[model samples]
Target: MSHVSVSADQAGQRVDNFLLARFRGLPRSRVYRLLRRGEVRVNGGRIGPEHRLQAGDRVRLPPVDLPPPRPPQQAPTRQLDELGACILYEDERLLVLDKPAGLACHGGSGIRYGAIEALRQLRPNQPFLELVHRLDRDTSGCLLIAKRRSTLRALHEQLRTGAVKKRYLALLTGQFAGRRQRVDAPLARYERGGERLVRVDAAGKPAATVFHARERYPQATLVEAELLSGRTHQIRVHAAHLGCPLAGDAKYGDPQAEARLGDIGLRRLFLHAAELEIAPLDGVGARHFSAPLPSALESVLIRLRQQTLTPSPP
Candidate 1:
């Protein structure tokens, strides 16, 4: 049996809880099995799973035999160029990668080799890097990744509890008369060309989004969006319902406007995950992550600004 002495900081937490906290990869069932077999002892005595640990308590642990590591998978030919890659923040538990436009978070449908798979190849030793949340393939900005299972669980719990804050920057194709507006619409799935799509339906699950116009251009408006409920394409569907579909949103916007926007470098949907705020577990502190507007979106903004300066004929 291996012995472990509890430190001051680890005191007050339960033995099973503390063991689970320290050894992230170990399953809870295994930990409890060790406790029941007297393989785990506290202060030279076998204790129950509910034993509260105290500072200076010496615990004995059984030798846990782990499986042999498997051979690493060969990565694809495409090497991630770090020069253009934006890293917003990183800690022992998490990494916030500023995902570029046109990169999928995970492989699906007919696409392969996504951001997470590429990152795995980039950092082979970190086999546990996992996506805490996802952004659409065309969306760009702050995307959180967890480095450990425990951290992933913690972050996911925070997301479920509505403790994490998410904000997006979008350009809509029409002038919004109101400065701030809230859309409380329910969304239901609809079928289009054999593909599933979400639409605002009164009988569907409730979804809400808050929009505030930041700047008004001659033909477009810059808006900040805050999502109260996370649903697939919530912001895009809601904005479309408000008669101001996002710029370059081909699937849900006016076809003529989409074609016009396409001529000006607004190729894909103009939605981005701009900022995220999450409270850290273990009482570390609150953390915030933000990514600058991607070059594609920034270029569109520049063109829009130039258009605003040109005088319109009465």
Candidate 2:
């Protein structure tokens, strides 16, 4: 029973995000339910959840039950401070952080207090905050945040045009040949027993990743991967297809290598978003950000190197 007008600042946002942002305590499932039933309309016409809003458009919001917001449900101040300390670079238009592993990029999908939620809580005064792109929850490293919708759109355009680049470092189970190798395979996402997974399928969308072997061990190889075309699980799936699944990747991994690495220190997914490069947007100059490998991962490599140096039993 309420109507809202989309302003210039609100343009380019998905209707779902706009609704969730406006209704703090709104249940995501409830929002989707309303959207599916056409209860939520824009410009007097029904639209799906992914529909983007435009300036000067009128949206009709039907009445719905919403729980009162709770302070306990919010992220703790200590965690927020820790996330703040991870900031690698911040400008009027963009913010970059060294996102740690196990912390998701955003909330929902059974996740609570993700990076975006924590940032919004920490900087309550900031009007605009949106993810420029998303990294897997198990993957750690450089993440981008756009402070304005205009900046978000510009960066998205750049991504579509291949102007934005990201470098990922992954530890594969088997020896990877060649100094640099490119995997050009399509990928498709499917669900099995309620768990979502991706695989290389001939009928899927085109995907590509270029990998540079950085270091090699008797049983493993460290490689830097440059994403040529962004796709879900492109690096992991491609690495597996190359006969060297990533170490510690339970979903798509080599079990024997996992057992071997367990002796050293491969306890988690060995993928890291090491670098990100954004080409100049409008008048803004190009920018680059990097994050060193986490110390735990560093220790794994150090131990592996030592193992390789030791003479085999005679």
Candidate 3:
């Protein structure tokens, strides 16, 4: 049996919510199942799923042994340096990496392993490296990895309390109206067969993004985006909603315009998580980290700059 105690800060939260927050790898459905089975109790009394927890509540959790660990697969034969892994910053608690385009943040679907696995192999003793958050496979730039579970929990708390700031660099297909704009819209997920996508819907969770145009050209605009809420595909959907879909975003861009850009080097989505700022867990000042533009994206920008010098039709 596991004895769990609630703190004053965790008061008023549902029992299931508290369990979910405490256990990282456990699924929410399983948490409810344990509650339903009366495997969980509070202060020597069995509580229902709707029980509202109060400060100093002692929670009794049934002993739950985690499943056996899976055998580690053989490391891939690819050259580690060729993977383009670059370290932006590193400390005892965390490592900020510049994730390259075309690599998944973590394995899913048919892919077996990802950068996290490779990094683990590179530093086997430091087995606690874990992704704090995720970035899309095609999106390149600053990704955070926590060195220990305690640091991960602290970083997650900061994210929940709005103490962390994230910014992205995007190349859009058209010129935006002003230097800066904010998009406040809700996002909902839609399933099409086996595929899932997010769209702006009134009934969905509240999402907000702020965009600032750094440079404007006839064909594309370089914009910086700051996320106010961390929803799936929030920035992509919000930018697409403004009719300035990102260049090479096949999922949401204009097919005709994409075809026209076949001659250019705009082959993949031109979005990168360029910067991240996190308040220090020790109550020190804020810490900021940034990843330089990957060569692929930088080459595209160079071409765009040359295009700007060319004369356009009246």
Which has the greatest TM-score?
2
Off by over 4 Å in 1: 1-79, 310-314
Instruction: Summing lDDT over every window of 10 consecutive residues in candidate 1, give the lowest-scoring window.
Output: 70-79
TM-score of each: 0.73, 0.87, 0.80
Candidate 2 C-alpha lDDT tens digits along 79-144: 888899899998788899899998989877667668988888888899888899989999999999
**TM-score, cand. 2:** 0.87
How do the residues 66-90 of candidate 3 rate in per-residue lDDT, one tens digit apiece? 5465566544656356443587888
**Candidate order by lDDT, highest to lowest?**
2, 3, 1
- Runs with alpha carbons beyond 4 Å of true place in candidate 3: 1-70, 74-79, 82-85, 310-314
Query: Which pairs clash in the backbone of model 2?
Result: 1-63
Clashing pairs in 3: none
lDDT of 1 by residue, 72-167 (tens): 444355446651256777778888899877888875465666788778877779868888888878888888888976687678778778888999
Model 3 lDDT on a 0 to 1 scale: 0.81
